[model samples]
Target: MRIVIFSDIHGNAVALEAVLAHIRHETAPDLIIVAGDLVADGPRPAESLAILRALPNTRFVIGNTDYDVVHERDIEYDFTRAQLSAEDLQWLDDLPFAQTVAAAPGRELLVVHANPCDLRAAIKPDHSPAIIRPLLDGVSQEIVAFGHYHVPFVRTVDRYTLVDVASVGFPRDGLLRAVYVTLTFDGANWQIAHHRIAFDAEAVARDYAAVGYPNAERKARKLLEARYRHP
Candidate 1:
């Protein structure tokens, strides 16, 4: 079975739409797995959720913002403080934390917004074992497909392979264009494929300005200008 894994789509319809368009044109997969962070931080939270609801054979998981909105019941979030409209706030409050155990016949994959270890926290690929070991428990198998940290790469531990599928909203600058992953599991063999799509970053910036998504333009600029936080 061919399963597509993606996440960290923080309401940037421009980016997300581009990714989806590419997916439709380039590949036809059996299922799509959304890691999480379904809304907030961008202009079109409600629109994003609506599109997600429309996807066929797709699984949507919860991100930190999804959990926060569900628990806090606030009209606006800190990331989009004074930016997101009231309707957008409502959209944020409505997403679910998704998981697919016993996934795709024989292969089991954990789908989480950020990390199985800490949903509310931001974790990187090269993290210490001590920090990430606890996050792997309770799940049937590791082979996790996740997002939340915008950068993409694979981290393989002794017992698991954590795949950070990256973010369409926040692409890693100076790298291959932002993308998700295609994992095919035929009984026991697992094959991975990375997919990339092109979007208008300038158009996205313009939308950010028009929607009043807090300091979206500035934050988005920061994400695009910098290579990585540590660098």
Candidate 2:
């Protein structure tokens, strides 16, 4: 089975489009998993959600930003909610925290926005096993995949192979390219591949001003820099 998973598309439809194009050109997987944060920080919130909704055979897991938008918990929530309709919000709210897929008869793959314990808890690449083990407390899957940190990484901890599929939009890994992961499972083992697609960073950055997105300057600057910045 071949599966593609991507997350942290913080409202940049342009970047998502580029990633989707890459997914179609290469790694035509059997299933696509959208590990969340669909919209809430950049421009084109509604459009981003619509694009992902149109995908076939895809599973979704809600992320911290999605949770905030649904519950109206953060400053960005109001702005994101203003751009979305009732149905869009309902779809975000209805997303599960985690999804499990059967890779083989006894092998399984787990997908989540972040760690299983908390959507806000990021599983960074540098974290030790002790820091990651508790996050996988009740997880029984041999392979676990997630996205939240926006940095791609694959780590093995005790019995679990943790895969951070990275961000499709708003990547903070010192690169402007949109990234995701593809998993190919043979009868017994899983092979992982990370794909990074270059999109028009300038166009996406300019979209903030074009759409009059809130905190446009800071967000645009962050996108160009490909790193997080304090607002």
Leading candidate by TM-score = 2
Off by over 4 Å in 1: 69-96, 101-106, 172-176, 226-231
Per-residue CA lDDT of candidate 2, range 60-90, in tens? 9999889889897655678889899999999
* Model 1 score (lDDT): 0.71
- What would the per-residue lDDT of candidate 1 be over residues 1-231, giving only the tens digit for each residue? 778888877676777888888778776878998887776666666677778768998877778867665555453565443444565555556555657756455468877887776676655777887777777767677488788877777877668887888887666545525577888877776777777776766666677667766676675675455254532
**What TM-score does candidate 1 reach?**
0.83
Alpha-carbon lDDT, every model: 0.71, 0.89
Provide TM-scores for the models.
0.83, 0.96
Ten residues in a row with the worst lDDT in model 2? Answer: 222-231
**Pairs in clash, predicted candidate 1:** 61-98, 62-97, 62-98, 117-135
